[model samples]
Target: MEASPTLKEQVSILEEQVGTYETVKSSLIEIEEESDVTEEDFSGITFYSDASVKLYDIDSAYINQLLGTYAIVRMSEKN
Candidate 1:
């Protein structure tokens, strides 16, 4: 049978995967923010900032989490 990867090897592979995921997530977020994301871009209804601003990728849980974190940062700054 084939041998499994050593702990070190597994960790290295995981780290690389994490790095790739981070890069893709960052790009997706940037695209969402720069361009207006429509319903076609996401499966759910898009988000809006007040009445004039629009949030991106409303259907993505990751995007929602990022927005929540961003709000927390801004709120902290105000205080």
Candidate 2:
């Protein structure tokens, strides 16, 4: 997936399958915004998985972010 399609390529393909270029481009923009993921600093993890773990990835990322934020608050309280 690293070599995924560029935005232009995706738009062109989608337009061909769906409708007009402008309409497809606008729809893609809206969909992208609706499905946007928050960026976070997640700890490196390694384990064997049958792909179910993939579903937990976003949940765990947010948990990691919350834990980091809590740690920062605790440190500030100590100071």
Candidate 3:
């Protein structure tokens, strides 16, 4: 059996996967300016942004939540 990653480890891995940290940060700031999300709304949430984003092995419920919140311009499956 394999052990699951800790929350900190998951966050670190997500950060590495989303290399454009500054770009994502700026985009989040812009989103905050345009939307009703406050700093408290962002607590314990991770933001990943890129020109062409790819998310692997994510939970369907979480994906649906993201889609509900943000506009996904493009998406495709690979398997």
TM-scores for all candidates?
A: 0.26, 0.27, 0.19
lDDT of 2 by residue, 1-79 (tens): 3644687798778778775766768877743355467877566766667866554346888989999999999999999
Better of 1 and 2 by lDDT: 1
- In angstroms, the error of model 3 at 42 is 50
Model with the higher TM-score, candidate 1 or 3 = 1
Candidate 1 overall lDDT versus native = 0.80
The candidate scoring highest on TM-score is 2
Question: Where's the lowest-lDDT run of ten residues in candidate 3?
Answer: 70-79
lDDT of 1 at 79: 100
**lDDT scores in order:** 0.80, 0.75, 0.70
Model 2 residue 58 CA deviation in Å: 6.4
User: Which stretches in model 2 have alpha-carbon errors above 4 Å?
Assistant: 1-58
Give the alpha carbon lDDT tens digit for every residue of 41-77 in model 1.
4557787769797766566888889999999999999
> Which prediction has the highest lDDT against the true structure?
1
Candidate 1: pairs in clash: none
Higher-lDDT candidate of 1 and 3: 1
* After superposition, candidate 1 runs with Cα above 4 Å error: 1-59
